[model samples]
Target chain A: MPKIVNHEERREQLAEAVWRIIRREGLEGVSVRSVAEEAGMSLGSLRHYFDSQSALLAFSMQLVAERIKKRIQSLPQDGDPRENIEALIGQIVPLDEDRLAESQIWIAFSTFALTEPELRPLSREIHDSLRDVFRNIFETLAQSQLLKPGLDTELEAKRFHALVDGLLVHGVIASEVVLAEEIAGIVARHLDSLLVP
Target chain B: MPKIVNHEERREQLAEAVWRIIRREGLEGVSVRSVAEEAGMSLGSLRHYFDSQSALLAFSMQLVAERIKKRIQSLPQDGDPRENIEALIGQIVPLDEDRLAESQIWIAFSTFALTEPELRPLSREIHDSLRDVFRNIFETLAQSQLLKPGLDTELEAKRFHALVDGLLVHGVIASEVVLAEEIAGIVARHLDSLLVP
Candidate 1:
């Protein structure tokens, strides 16, 4: 009998190779040949998954987004709004090696997006989607009557988004100086500032 | 009499060319020949100013930090403390064309720093120095009795730095969505949050 090849699994394996290349050699090191070597697969085999470097990078970037989305979707939905919110947002911040790598690659892709017209929209989508998520969080708090009286939801949402991005960047770049617990603590405190006081 | 060449001016011109290339083409487009052509100079002339592509890139990156440092240094030291802080931080954010270019290059250089071992220290230095600057800002606030009573200067300093960086990244990446004024507003509110109410 012929061996069974799972296409989705192979694609993920190729994407992981891309991440490893990014982690080890930066985005510039992710040519087809390099990724193929990193994946321990032949170039021809890798080509079956991604036709070009750009396609590979785009897929890899998408995979990072999907992974975060999946994690967020899988979070416990026990309906403690505050805890749910915190747990959901925490997945995006670089709390551990896996997340730090994701954050680093996100930054790399974002930087690359600034110059690459084709990738610009993808970067914008991620930024805007994250902002929307924060907006919904604010809306949820407001609906539950937990937000501060007379607080503007729009501005507060933007502030929350900015705070999240800031904390994530600090956590990733200066992890030695700013521990993940500090980031979480800040988030908790900032969230407190939003509630009725 | 021989034409007096201003070496500093020429180097600045070349760095501008490097910036244009980065803005127009991408980091990968930067080469000695390309920069020489962009700067309207001979390859040998450009080589005299920058011995190699890496040297040119390093200097260009250094020039960006120097530019921001110069801007911060030139801000009036006579304004109110809060206003002074706002204005000083504003110079680093991308409020206009020149600053936008600086911010964009800063991002590119930072991402490039991820895998470039030599550039890594420069990136770390900027991160640490920014943290120190924020620390000083918090110290200034504390000395003036402007900060919330018993606030942790170290943590607040880190938070302040993270806020500034987050605003900058947001301003650059999603300028259409997050305006400079919103960033300023957020900063003002955050500063207010840290003050005794």
Candidate 2:
């Protein structure tokens, strides 16, 4: 009998290899050949799953977005408004190695998205989707009477979203000087500022 | 008579060419040969200044840091704390076409800095140098009673720096969603938060 290969599992396996390539050698090292070699698979075998470089990259990036969304979605549903907000934002920042890798890969793909039109939709979609999470969190807080009266939920949502993106990038690039803990504290403070006085 | 090439000027020209290539074709498109061709010079001539591909990239990255520093230093010295802080922060953000191109190239180099050890020092230097500017500005502001009392100058500076860096990255990557005016307004609001009551 011929060996059975799960195509979905195989594609994910290929993506993990790509992730390792990004984690070890950076995004510039993630060519088809390199990824296949890293995956311990034949180039022909890898190509069967992802026919083109862009397809492979898109799949890998989508996996990243999904994983992050899943983590946030998995958070316990019993926390207070502040606790839940912090949990949601915490999942995105580089508070741990997993999130750090995600942040690094996200930054790498973001630059690639600028020049590769094929990647823009994924980038924009991930961005819009992430902001939606923030919006939902803000709306929840607003309804709970945690948000200051008359605060513009839309603008506050956008600010909090931008703040997370900014902190992640700066934390990655200037991690030596701007420690992630310091950023998390500032974020906590920023979140606190939204509460009713 | 063969026109004597001013090696320094030629280097600036080449770096400028690299910048142009980066802006026009993306960082992935840059090469010693491409840069040479862009500058209308031979590869031999280009190699005289940058002995290796890494060397050329290091110099190009350094050129970006220097250009930004020069622009910040060029700000008039009337030295109103608020004006100076705003101008310095503005220099780093993508406010206009020229600065935007510089920002695009800077973001490209920022990702390259992750994998290339050769480029890391320049990245660290630029990172620290910019961080220090904010640090010094905050220190000055703190001393002048412009900043809110009890704020840690260094920590607040890092927060402000991170805020600016984060906003710039999102602006570059998600400009359609996070408009330039919105980013500017966020920066202004954040800065206002640092002011004395």
Candidate 3:
């Protein structure tokens, strides 16, 4: 065999380049040629990694999900349900410059997915996973009797999920009006209202 | 003398063609050539109204806003404040087939506008006007002494606006799970919680 380049490391490097292009120039700028240039690699090498444009986009989208999952996983295990939930929700919001760029890219991808059939299944899977994360958190609160008695868990789960998604979208658009700190405060207040008396 | 086509009607006809193309083939399908074909007019004739693609898109976007304003103006005045608000909110949601089609076009345009700087100002203006409509309704309720005494009108306004936007985004993606009726129920409950004691 010729000199063996680490494929996984190379893929990570390409995905990071994809993120950078998306951050700097929006999704429309993320072609294979552009990404290859951004990664300081030959087009052939990038093609060897991703095969096609859809494959590259799909992989990039999955990378975003993985980063979010990793961030949530890295949170300390303090064992406080509310703290955990808050931390998890906080990760999705645009609290800093990096996350804000990611949010913009995420929103752009979700929109493009609506018309592009190849991306729809992945989008659906990511959405289901997010809803499940919220559902599990709500279930934990219910088990701990943290949620108000007689609370409709399913409906509350949907509402809470909507609240986070809503906050992220508005924050992406009108950051001046809906800052990350304010979003956290709103989340805290909403959660406090739902807690057991 | 040449026959004079009604300017207002011709504009509406052109916008309708744009809407059809957006719904049937997505925003990327919307080009001067495609829209002219869809409208059964030559590109030269279409040029008489819109000098450029950006101008065409801006006018199409504004037409959607105008339609919404007209719908709101037509709602009967016999309903109570709660009913009026619900009805107003209902108009924005994809309750029926026609509104659902319009929503698909509306969302696609919003995504396109995000990347197109020329269209950004018009998008911002439309969004501000939409928010003002919501703000005025909330202000009405507060002024009429129908809302809770200590309610933060601005916070509630933004929250409600976010809730509606959240529902629309999710509705486009996961409408089967997050039904429109459920969103209406959530809105109703959120409003009921703030009703004056």
Candidate 4:
């Protein structure tokens, strides 16, 4: 039989090649030629998957978003709300080698998206999705009767989002100085302040 | 009369040119030729000021740091402690057009600094200085006895730093949706959470 081609798997392999190049040489290092070389594939084959640089970049960025979604989905929701929150926050942060790489890719793509208008929609979609995620977490608190009285869920959700964002950005940029436990501590304190006795 | 040139002013003009390009076209839009055209100067004249592309980029990035330093220095300190803290936070956020431009350049440069080993020190320097600024603000609160009892000033300062960073990142990436007033409100709420009764 002729060689079977799994197009989805091949595309993912190519996207991973882009991620590897981005990690090794920054966003500037990604192009059809370089990615193909990284993937040990011919340039034409890579082009068959990604017609242009922006298309490849957009796909790679979207891939990052998809992975974030997958991680969030995989968190155990059938648990103590606090544990679920911890697991969700843990998934977002760069706590280990895998997460650190994802965070790096995220920073790279997010920055690139700022300048590329075509990618702006994807950026906004991710932004809104994140906001919704935080909102849902807050809503979960409300449903469990865990939220403090007089708390504005909308504002609290946004604040929580900002706190997580801050920790993630610091943990990646200043990883040498910031520790995982400290990040957890900050998140925990923010939660305690928002919680009722 | 001989034609006169204020070297510092000329450099500022070129850096501003770089900033415009960064805000309008992203970091990749920047090059010696493009910058010279944007600066309305001959390439030879531009080279007279900056020896190479990397040198120009470094100086441009440093100019951003200098503006940040200048803004912080110029903040009125002889005010109510809360007002002083607010002013300090205001300086770090992208509230106005000029600040927004600076922030755009900052995000672009900071992202570029990653994967670039030689530029990491500058990025670290900015990161450290930002930490000190936040720490100093919390110290101001402590001096005025504004902090809530039994609070950890160090952790609060880091949390505050992260909050501002997240706002900056979000404000720029999703500027269409995030507002200046909202950013201010979040900052105020964070402070209120930490203030004495």
Candidate 5:
């Protein structure tokens, strides 16, 4: 039998290699050559999958987004709304090793996207999707009568989004100061403040 | 007579060149040679001011921190506590062109610092200083009897710090979505929530 390769699996493996390099050396260190070397593949073979460095980076970032989306989708939604929401956010923030790595890759990609116009669309899409997540959380709270009456859900959604993102940034950059426990506590406190007293 | 050159002024000029390059081309475009060309100076002359690229980047980052600190210090201290706090935060977020530039440079440098060990201290110093800024805001509110009763100022400080930073990141990365007015409004609303109602 001839050798067979699963293209999607191979691409994911290459993306994981990109993530490892990003975590260890920052996005600036990411290039097609370096990624191919890290993935233990020849440069020509890597090119067959991703024609350019920009395409490779976009795929890596997209994979991060997809993983978070899949995790959130698989989460149990039948439990307490607050706990469910926390669980959803837990997958986004850097609470554990896997999440910590994801957050690092995210920040690295986000900062790089600021200057790379070709990468900006993926960054914007992720931003919009995250905003929807926050919006849906507020909607769920309002539908369940968990939100305080007369609160502007739109503005509150924006605030909640900003707060979570800020926590992610702080958690990644100054994990020593803003510990994981503190991040969870802050989220819980914010959630409590939203509910009827 | 020989022309006189102000050493400090010249260095600031070079730093400004670095800032322009960062804003235009991102940090990846920054190099001693590139910066020298951007500043209309010989590479040898630029090296006289900054012996290495690392030294140049450090000084540029330090200049940003100092500018922010100077701006904060110059703000009038005698004012309504809420407004004072708002004004203090105004200097930190991307509310204006100068601040937007500062924030871009900051995000770029902060992401770069993640894998650059030599730059970590400066990043940490800025993080600590920003934390102190938030801590003092809450303390000031408490002393003035403006804070809501029974609120945990320590945790609130961290939350407030994270929120403003989150706002800053959104403002820089998604200015069209977040908007300047939205950033200001979010800060005002957060302050209102902190006060006696």
Candidate 6:
């Protein structure tokens, strides 16, 4: 009998290989051949999954987004709105090793997408979706009567989005300076500032 | 008689070429030879200044930081603390074409620095300096008797730093969504939140 290969699983394995290369050598070091070599697979087999470097990079970037989304989706939503929102953000920032690797991959892809037109759509989609996530968080606070009266939810949403992204960058790049606890504190302080005192 | 070349001016020209290449093709396209070609100089001549690719990148990144520092230093200090702080931040975020280019170059270099150990010190230095700039802004507000009473200036400084850096990233990556005007507005709102109301 012929061996069975799970195509989806194989693609994910290749994407993980791309992540390892990105984490070790930066996005600039990522190429189809390098990724194939990293994955311990032949070029032909890797090409069967990702026909080109751009396709591989896009998939790798997409996987990072999906993992974060899945984690956020699986979080318990029965807690206080504040804690729920905090829990949601905790998954976004690089608070641990896995998240740190994800954050690094995201930043690398984001920088790459700036000049690679082919990758911009996915990058923009991720950016838009994250923006919506922030907006919904504010809406949830307002619905729960936790937000300050007369606050502009839209503007607050944008500010909060920027704050979290900035923390993400600082957490990944300047982890030594901005510790994990400090990132959480900053997020809590930001959330508190938007609520009724 | 032999023609004279201004070494400092020539180095700046080469750095500008690196910026143009980075803006156009991303940092992945930046090599000493590529920069030499972009600058319309021979590799032999380019090597007279930068001994290696790492040296070239480090200098280019340093130039970006220095340019921003110079702009901030030249801003008039005699205005209202709020406006002064806003103007100072204006020099940091990508509010215009020149700044937008600088931001893109900075982001590219920063992402490149992640896997380049030789480039980490300059990246860390720039990060530390920017954090200090935010700290000084809060101190200015406190000295001017404009800060909100009982606010933790340290935490507020970190929050403000994150917010502005976030705005910078958004202004560069999602210029279409965030817009220049929105970045300015976010900074103003953040500053307002820290001041006496």
Taken in order, the candidates have interface RMSDs of: 1.4, 1.5, 1.7, 1.0, 0.6, 0.6
Name the regions of candidate 1 deviating beyond 4 angstroms.
none
lDDT (tens digit, per residue) of candidate 1 on B49-140 = 88887788888988988988998999998988889998988888877878878877877887887788777777788888888889999889
- Each candidate's TM vs. the true structure? 0.93, 0.94, 0.93, 0.96, 0.98, 0.98
Off by over 4 Å in 6: none
Model 4 ranges with Cα > 4 A deviation: none
Give the alpha carbon lDDT tens digit for every residue of A1-197 in model 2. 99998988988999999999998877778888998999999988888888877788889999999898898889998967688878888889988778888988998898888888888999898888888887898889878888877777887777777778878987777666666678789787787567875
RMSD in angstroms, all models? 2.0, 1.8, 2.1, 1.4, 0.9, 0.9
CA lDDT, candidate 5, residue B76: 95
- State residue A34's C-alpha deviation in candidate 5, in Å: 0.8
Query: Tens digit of lDDT per residue, candidate 4, span B1-197?
Result: 99899999999999889888888888889899999999899999999999877777888889988988998898887887887888878887888877777778777777888877777788788889999988988887888798998888998999888889889888888888788899899988888888986
* Docking quality (DockQ) of candidate 3: 0.55
Residue-level lDDT for B31 in candidate 6 = 91
DockQ of each: 0.65, 0.64, 0.55, 0.77, 0.85, 0.89
Clashes (candidate 4): 0
lDDT tens digits, residue span A1-197, model 3: 79888999999999999988876666778899999999999998899999877788889889888999999999986777888888898888888877787777777788778778888888788888988988988898999989978877877777777778877877776655667778887787778768865
Q: Highest DockQ among the candidates is held by which one?
A: 6
Off by over 4 Å in 2: none
Sorted on lDDT, highest at the top, how do the candidates line up?
5, 6, 4, 1, 2, 3
lDDT of 3 by residue, B14-106 (tens): 999998887776777788999999999999999999888888888888888888888988998687888999999888877766667666766
Task: Encode model 5's per-residue lDDT on A99-142: one tens digit a residue.
Answer: 88888888888888988999998898999999999999999899
**Angstrom error at residue A62, model 6:** 0.9
Q: Give the Å shift of residue A122 in candidate 3.
A: 0.9
Question: TM-score for chain A of every candidate model?
Answer: 0.94, 0.96, 0.94, 0.96, 0.98, 0.98
lDDT of candidate 5 at residue B67, scale 0 to 100: 97
List, residue by residue over A5-95, the lDDT tens digit for candidate 6: 8999989999989998998888888899999899999999888888888899999989999999999999999987788999999999999
Task: Give the Cα error of residue B97 in candidate 3, in Å.
Answer: 2.6
Highest-lDDT candidate? 5
